[model samples]
Target: MIPTPEIRHVNVTRYITPLREGGSLPAVADADDGFKYVVKFKGAGHGVKMLIAELIGCEIGRVLGFKVPEVVFAHLDEAFGRTEADEEIQDLLKGSQGLNIGLHFLSGAINFDPVVTTIDAQLASEIVWFDAFMTNIDRTFRNTNMLMWHRELWLIDHGASLYFHHSFTNWEKGAQTPFALVKDHVLLPQASELDTANQKLKSLLTPQVLQDIVNLIPQEWLEWEGYEQTTEEIRAIYFQFLTARLAQAEVFTKTAQDARKALI
Candidate 1:
């Protein structure tokens, strides 16, 4: 089993500016650690569920040897919002005056464009496999949430993944669900070795790895209404869902292969 990552906890010292590109309105904030982070507020429209998805998706990507930014738990003080001029931003700070998610900001990074940058076949195939396993629908060609920094590609903004947690009433429906949208993936055409990638990466995500990744999510984030399960119980549900998906990885792997074939 891979070592459990120690998630850093920091306090937000100052709110630098709002990143208005995303619908949730994430902001760049100066943390006490003397680093800048793109903070995802819990009060955002998507709520804490998005934060949970971001954390889980990031951890999974990291375990698969993908380039993902470091994530931290940032404590937002209520007084920090009083100085903000924008009412919307101030409200966001006020509501998220506690534990929020922060992603280490990559300075001087440019948005990845397939036209300008070429991804290697192996890396591309692994990334496509990972996204297919996670049921991530956000990595489409139009809004490729990828960045090129220092001539290397980095994954970012995984709030749209693990979408099954949004509604737990019929959560079982998500298990083993075929990801038909893999065809729209930005890297599908470049993913030439899906079979090899799947074989190699599948072993990395053992049950212990899945449990460890799910355990990284804050308990409060899982305390949604309409769920009868306790926080730990809810976490187990996520493990079960992922384990089921992993067991059926071949189904999604074939889907991605077919998509790549069509693109070629």
Candidate 2:
């Protein structure tokens, strides 16, 4: 289990708003540390799955040496003195208090846009490869979840990934392509350079490390359709795919490096 972080409380006002495309209520809370943070309510059933996935993903990303937001599980209470709007939304946010999740908000973060500074091809390619291994279909250009903060790319909003686990277990339907998500979704600018990205990914996808990481996720989270056996089988499938992909990544990485050396 990942160590939980300590949450602090302050007597300050918060502004709450509904996100355009997501299911959670996002609120901006003032911190004594003088920074405003974003906290999403975990009361809704839809938000619950997202909260769990984000927590696990952030930790894994950190282990993989990626820059992720400082996150903590928190509780918003009536004692903190909230706004009338917040109170109105409290019903929607009910049961989230004392167990809400907060992200130390990035003050000036911007969403990724291809028209903006281009993400490095090799780096982007690796991200796509990682998504494929995890079967994530939500990071498309139509709803790109990458955030540009301090000139680095940060991933966010993974509520839509691992969606196959939600449906009934009919192997034929499950194995079908177009897996309830568009396969040819727009790629990140660097995604086309898979040969280079695959190389890097191969080096990173060690079997032991991948197994350790996946095992860390709560068994409850892995279980699909409320069945533990199904969840275990699904995890095994991903593990096999990831292992093979890692080997491929190593080959690609070597080829790319050799090509680069030759050019130099």
Best by TM-score: 1
Per-residue CA lDDT of candidate 1, range 99-171, in tens? 9999999999999999988999999999999999988999988999999988899999999987888777666
Candidate 2 positional error at 141, Å: 1.9
Give the poorly placed runs of model 1, Cα more than 4 Å off. Answer: none
* Total residue pair clashes for candidate 1: 0
lDDT of 2 at 205: 48
Q: What is the TM-score of each candidate against the true structure?
A: 0.97, 0.65
Q: State in Å the error of residue 139, model 1.
A: 0.7
Q: lDDT per residue, candidate 2, 1-264, as tens digits?
A: 333323354433464445546546566766555566676665655645565556545555555555667766555565543335556466655555545556677778998887776877666666665555445677877778778888888877655554544553543333333222334334433455766565555565466666765554444445445554676776665455445544444443444334334433
Best by lDDT: 1
**Pairs with backbone N, CA or C atoms under 3 Å apart (clashes), candidate 1:** none
For residue 53, model 2's alpha carbon misses the true position, in angstroms, by 1.4
Given candidate 1, what's the lDDT at residue 210? 89
